[model samples]
Target: MTVTRTLALLLALIAAAAFAPIGPARAQSEGPLRIEITEGVIEPMPFAIAPFIAADSSAEDYTGRITRVIANDLASTGLFREIGRDAHIGRVTSLDAPIQYADWRAINAQALIAGRASVSGGRITLGFRLFDVVSGQQMGQGLEFAGDVDDWRRMAHKIADEVYSRITGEEGYFDTRIVFVAETGPAENRTKRIAIMDQDGANLSYLTDGSALVFAPRFSPTGRRILFTSYDSGFPRIVLLDITTMRRQIIGEQEGTMTFAPRFSPDGDTVVYSLSVGGTTDLYSLDLTNGQRRQLTNAPSIATAPSFSPDGRRIVFESDRSGSSQLYIMPAGGGEAERISFGQGRYGTPVWSPRGDLIAFTKQHEGRFHIGVMRVDGSEERLLTASFLDEGPTWAPNGRVIMFTRQNAGGDPALYSVDISGRNLRRVPTETAASDPAWSPSLP
Candidate 1:
């Protein structure tokens, strides 16, 4: 997405998500969203992950390194804690050696993971298993991966997914990838374009020519195509581009209306956006399957920045019908939108967390912008960053970290990340100035 429109939509979204309420009932307290889930209280899992044993002399090169990467990925999630390397008791270089459950229990680790890496010719194969220390039994069947040596990280992520799914009974996020805007250049004339990369910031590839401004690029659920808004015609319109071939097609045939803030439904068969007609903006949804269009909101006030919930049964967007912008959730097919945010600021760019538990947004209050999260019902507002301008938050596939753009007045803009808890803030360095970050779904 173009930097200006991206920031503008975020500005509108922040106004929609954090504005002051107009009525005495407190719009947010109308009632919790119907899709609310009572996620159980989470406790860190103590896991002992050791280097994969090499099955033969040929496999020695990547034995320890590959296993270490797997362990590190799991530990970094914050849900799993790794037992220190120095605390390891009995080493199992081969999966066949029975695990010493007592030793892992001594370290207070509930789960023990052991694996072996083998290379036959040019292909690499990995096998791993998770053990329940308390039960003294294998938690699930062993997992195996086969790929080229260059795909070792993918294999590791798959192994982590298996373990995560087995323990939590929830779908694993490790298999996902993120598609974001890779930016470089000055603040005013930034060389921004669409880019795809792994969730860990690796294997980055440019998807646009950098000749025009692209903003808010979102991946289809299948990751085969990307839906974004571009200003190739000097006015923004919703466009869909095939990520692989870079071919694109604009959705609407309107002559003068400008479209912005586009997103794909969970099914990836529909797109929702705001179209400005004669200076009045409203919400509309287009069926990608048939090119049919339907209006969702017709208020003179703007109803922009639409996002679909995970189940695709509802949508959360920002509207200014109350004189100022605030978050609103409504049925995906179209209905009354219940206001969700009642804070003393403007809320904008409301993006639902992939986990379906929280909504991340941009907030502006008292001359400063902030990136924050709140329940779908607009409860428990937690701001993650505050600065001259912090906007455009995209969640990591895992939902534990958020990436966005931060601009300091006339200074260069850059991409930064912070844990959802507002900790572990760090900047993601690019070859040049980067903004308008759009994280992709997990890689195929």
Candidate 2:
């Protein structure tokens, strides 16, 4: 099957699974169900997690540390409530020992997690299990992992993933990283380069020399290559750089044209970008393997900020062919275009949702910029944020939230995220002023 077809099928399956009618057998099964999220409103599942036990002196010191990591991971998701250590009526010290189910239930914990840690020859081993507090039954067989002692974070994230999957029936995004363009200086003379860090903003490292102007860095689905635009020669050109080797080359380096706003296909083998030949801009796709190029749109008006749907069969982009810049959808190989936005203000930068349910964009009206989202059909449009110059709406891995660049009243830019419900607005701190943020897909 074609890459676009496969993606479309996979997205369709995921959507079916997400929005399918629930059978009576799975509708929160009444009392003592232990752990489950009923409806979209997450009723935080109460979980009792005691400090892991240790098999030796070295393991003893790491027990509390590692378990704390696990607890924090679960708590941060806002779906699992951790019983305070003081309220832990039961203290579990080993995975092999019995768990006091009544004690956990007495503390109002619906679930319990127990683990044991061991360290020898600089390697760490973790064994853990999840249990039903009320029924006093093990939910799943225990899991074991071995790794270097320094990889405790990974171990914690893996445990969180297992717990999340067991309870929520959805994948966890805790094990992901975000690569974005870090910015500083003034907007006209912005100093920007590619930098990556943990999804929560840690371990930041720059990938470029920071001497040229770069914009819109996007990670390949596999995160092996970065596709972005650069003005190193005083004219914008599409560039692809290897994340691991730091080697770079100009892609779609056509003569007398400016190319920008690039993104990788869902399969990570092709790049779709906007190229301006003369004064008219259009969308083009370039095959990474053989340098083949195909024009996807031909219009007199500007057609920039092209994004492929998860299945890659269609492209969502911003174009002014209808007078003002608005969102449009077209076949990936080029065909009749359908307008998806008819809102009052001008819209640009239409990005397909990771889950393929909606398209996010930047809207300008009343001298203010706002980040908004709408169904692919252009219905149910909702604005998530408004500011002096808020633009560049990027979706979280799960499509439950959006992160965008926000310029304060004074034009100081920073990264901020708001839940799709327009709640939980929080500023993501970076080392410097940042904008043009692009979030990566969920990590493996």
Candidate 3:
């Protein structure tokens, strides 16, 4: 049989094996498995991950690491709780081994994951199957991946993504990357460089040498390029850098003008940013393909931090036209604008969610900073975080979580992530003080 057909047949067999009758003790969880994002307290669902079997001696070294990464990814979301391995009645020794449903049910494991890892000829292979303990069935198809050994972590992330999606009925964000500004030295004279890392803070590497100050690193839709603000010429300028070759060039450069807070259009063919000329900053769009520039906003006030909606037809930006910083939305072609923020605080850094349903922004009010989201029409505002200095909110690819910069009084800045429901606020690990986090879409 062909490889694809063989894999399909194997998955069919696995599914067949999981169709055993459900047990009485596990009957309570017979319905669909899902986690609802809400403001109320949630009891995380309990799941069990059997240590992945090493199908070959060469795979033993990677089995433990892959399992740990998958466990961490699921646990970090706070929606799934992992049962300790010590509590398990038996272990998964092979890919086709029958699951001991009674043992897993005894430990109150609603979901179970079993996987196998094998390595040969400089390539690694991973396979995993998720089971619904209550129904005594496989949640979905058994999946497998083969890639270079160095890409083992990404394969693990893909496995985690599959398990998460099969359970929550939503797209997973674990197989992604984050670009941010890495800062060193004291707060006053800090040196900032553009850096990128995996979502779990592994595989960190710097894109810039810290010779010039860089800020607000935004990933392109393809995750192959980055747009950021650089102060190399003693002025803030928007620059585009290719992640593969590390080649960079200035964008929308004009004599005696400054540009910052650049973000890519949904199609990655254009860039929308704030350009300051003669002390008046306004929003502009640059066509990257043909080197054409169009003014998107013409006002006597400071208009900056422009972000494009997912449809690429409208732009949401922060402006001080009303004498205080607030959010405004306008057509991509530059026309009449509508104010979208009407609250007690001054709002800035408005980013439209990838789902095109809501906008996230930074709000400062009454000596405190907040990261908040609101309906596109500016209603139903909900604040997700409040701290001494929290700003620059960026949404995950799935639009369910927001990561932003948070710094306490007399403390250095760091990256933090919070669910849209304001649960599971956690610090993102970094080698240095990190800020201006931008999440990339899932890797191809």
Candidate 4:
């Protein structure tokens, strides 16, 4: 099967049903311990991941690698704490071995994970189970995944997605990708190229070279194309890149005007972007099926960075119509925009959340730049990170986390991610500096 097909199977296995409560079976006589995500988390919930049982001697190396991946996925969320490998007291020797709940409880583990892996017929088959040691019961249905032996890392991620979804009562985003601008060189002369990588900073690849200056690379809904601004022709042009063909088409480039900062509509049939003409920048949409253009914003002030709501009914964008950069919402076609941001800052790069409930943005206030989010209607505003320069907020596939560029004074740009709850702030491991990351929807 193709990579996309395999991803479809993974999502089907993990997300076909709505989120159930994260605990033991509801019919249990005794109450089960659970983690409330909204509650103040003083510490991460403790869990243990045992070495996966190798169904064959040929799978022994893979068993340990896959087990560590599951442990890292849970630990990185800042919700589950993995007890050190040295703390292990029990192991699984068979695919159907009984979990030693007493051993897990003795080590203060609230939850335990066990699995078995096998290599056969040029394929790898994996089976995993989750247990609630506190309640001494299985957490959910056991799962099995089969795939090519070379795709062991992807299988590990698929398993991790299942474990995360069952324990967090939320959709899993592990099987996703991020496109960004990879940077190198000094602060004064930084060179950037369009780059792609897995959510965990693995499988890194540069899609473009440093010959052109690129910014704000947004993925299409199908994740097959990318829209970004490139300054290769002495003026910025919005370029559409087909990943499979490695071909580029500059969208709506006229002789006199410069077009930049392009983004796709929810359905991916059209693009909305900024076109600077005669000292005025306005928002415009280009029909990809036909070379048709419609101006969405004809304001005197600069209007740019337009993002569509999930349903395509509305668009949120940044403009300086009110004498300061702020966020506004309007109809997808064209209409009066209602101001959504009225905070003590200059806001830019407003991105509507994939969940459609919140809008993430970059705010500059009190001599500091912060990544912040607010309700779609611009209420309940909360800032997630602060740095000398924090901008271009992009939501994770599940809308639970935001990734953006963070640069300090006289420093180069790099990529960082923060949870929507204002926790788990960490830098994405990149060999070079990175910025303007756009997360792809869950694959397949």
Best by TM-score: 3
| lDDT of candidate 1 over 1-444, digit per residue (tens) | 122322343244233222121112212112211111123444567888877888878778887777776776666556678887789886775677778878888888887888878887666777877777877776655655666777777767767766765665443456556566666766568777877665555567788878888877887877788887888888998778997787889886488789988888988999988899977898899998898999999888899888899899889998889988889999998898899999999999899998899999999999999999999889999998999999888887657678899988987777888778786677765655667676666555
Stretches of candidate 3 exceeding 4 Å from the true structure? 1-31
The residue-by-residue lDDT of candidate 2 on 180-279, one tens digit each, is: 7888777778789877776666667888778998878888886678888899888998889887898899988888899899988898888889999878
Q: Which rank order by TM-score, best down to worst?
A: 3, 4, 2, 1
TM-score of each: 0.80, 0.85, 0.93, 0.92
Off by over 4 Å in 4: 1-8, 11-33
- Give each model's whole-structure lDDT: 0.76, 0.77, 0.88, 0.84
Cα RMSD (angstroms) for every candidate in the order listed: 12.3, 6.8, 5.5, 4.3
- State how far residue 289 of model 2 sits from its true place (Å): 1.6
Show where candidate 2 strays beyond 4 Å: 1-43, 60-65, 186-188
Residue-wise lDDT of candidate 4 within 142-192, one digit each (tens)? 667776777677778877877677677666777778999999887677789
Candidate 1 yields a Cα-based lDDT of 0.76
Candidate 1: Cα lDDT at 345: 96
Candidate rank order under lDDT? 3, 4, 2, 1
Clashing pairs in 3: none
Q: State the displacement of the C-alpha of residue 222, model 2, in Å, after optimal TM-score superposition.
A: 1.0
TM-score of model 1 relative to the true fold?
Answer: 0.80
